[model samples]
Target: MNIGVIIIIVISLISIAGFSRPELIYKYQFNAWQIKNRKEYIRWISHGFFHADWVHLAINMFVLWSFSKAVIYYFMRSLPGNSSIVFLVFFFSAIVASSTFSYFKEKNNYNYNAIGASGAVSAVVFASILYDPFRIIYLYFIPIPGIVLGIGYLVYSRIMSKRNVDNIGHDAHFWGAVYGFVFPILLNPSLLGHFFNELLAIF
Candidate 1:
């Protein structure tokens, strides 16, 4: 099994367990106040293992599974040694990095809490887009190029983050997607040139 799928399975099981045990949610879910007052820093990464509901878990897993191979392929092909380990680091760190902005922004709002893998999934999706800019991605069952979907995703997430009208963690999604695009390039700077080359070819 691919590392990405393995991660999905692990998180799915944990999330399912969390659904039945409210305490699990309380213990693992991202709570800005808990971290600020109690020093429960684990919430930063632990939150990725829980979700608001099964639907939320399913959607995030599906997207992650869909794009996992592309990201893993590019990483293994371009980087030296232990690609799986490297990818795992990229994935988990993204979960935390994506939420760092929110942690500081909401730490004092005792009611602020979030649960889901959307942030990590968004990171995986954008990373895949970086590798295959012209690949086909289904947007609401309609075929659209990956690059187009990526742009739409970024814009929508940014706007939604600013509005904060919904419970959704658009902030995490936006930052995660940004991290996804940059982390790989950090691993291999050549990817920056490759990204531009593929982007221009899309014209």
Candidate 2:
């Protein structure tokens, strides 16, 4: 089975369990106040495996499934022997990286809580975009170039994060997308040149 599919299955099961047993969410959901006060640091990773509802879970899994194969393909090309392990590391690390800002921002807010795989999903998405900038990304049946969508996503996330008007973790999405685009370059600096070449070719 693909690593992405396995992740979807595991996350879905855990999220479903959390739906029936709300205590699971309380224990595992991202609560920066709890981490600061009670030292429950595991929530950084645990929260990604749980989600608020079926729509959240389904959207995350669908995007992840759509992009994981391409990202892994590029990973295999860039770091041949350890692609799978590297992909897993990339996915999980995004969860932590994505939440770092929120942790600091909400450390004192006792009422704040969050749970979802959006960060990791965004990571996979932007990583795929980095690999193929001109690839067509379908949003609600409308096709948009990956580079265009990536820029729009970043702008939207940044604006939304600053507004702080929604329960959605826009900060996580922004950072996760940034991390995804940079990770492969960090591993193999030459990929940065490839990204530029692919991006400019469409012009």
Candidate 3:
């Protein structure tokens, strides 16, 4: 878990300086170059690893660390020896999905830019809901059912998107949650525990 977090931190630090050291990594930003270039498409994954400030980085990390291990755990227990591959798939897919959504949505807003793993992190959080829908997420001081929290988050992002908020890719957040919602439902197919029993046999 520490290694997972360290990788995210290093990428964020290298990227966070985009505000101050644009000369070095500007081309790597998730903007025109990402939309235009082909070979450097990995920016879709790389961009999700960094954030703009301490608070931004901290929240992203807390969510990633809090939920990702559980995500990996279930996959590993179910499909032993395949944890790494599944994780890679879930991770990279969320990133690319989020990135593609943002690129198409932001083509005209030249000032639009994003710098957080919230989209991918949102995937992890909502994935947890698929596993445990009744679970509680203390999203705020008040306790809210995790599913409600997830839906609330989507609504908030959608509202923010319509308002044309600056500097935030609300579309990515909404779609990432949408991805998280869809991923396990497609994979597991049932709210019952049957998915786990069969999934484990795959190992």
Provide the TM-score for each candidate, comma-separated.
0.97, 0.97, 0.79
lDDT per residue as tens, model 1, 42-152: 998999999888789889989888888778888899866677888899899999989998999998998899989888889988888888888899988999998898999
Over the stretch 115-181, how does candidate 3's per-residue lDDT look in tens digits?
Answer: 6677888888877776766567786568897767877898999999789757777888888888876
- TM match of model 1 to true structure: 0.97
Q: What's the true lDDT of residue 52 in model 3?
A: 71
Tell me the tens digit of each residue's lDDT in model 2 across 86-175: 999999999999999999999999999999989889999999988898899999999999999999999999999999998999999999
RMSD of 1: 1.0
> What overall lDDT, based on C-alpha atoms, would model 2 receive against the true structure?
0.92
lDDT of each: 0.90, 0.92, 0.69
Q: Could you tell me which residue pairs clash in candidate 3?
A: 12-50
Lowest summed lDDT over 10 consecutive residues: which window, candidate 2? 77-86
Model 3 regions lying over 4 Å from their true place: 1-20, 32-34, 37-40, 78-81, 108-110, 191-203
Report the alpha-carbon TM-score of model 2 versus the true structure: 0.97
Q: Which ten residues in a row have the lowest lDDT in candidate 3?
A: 191-200
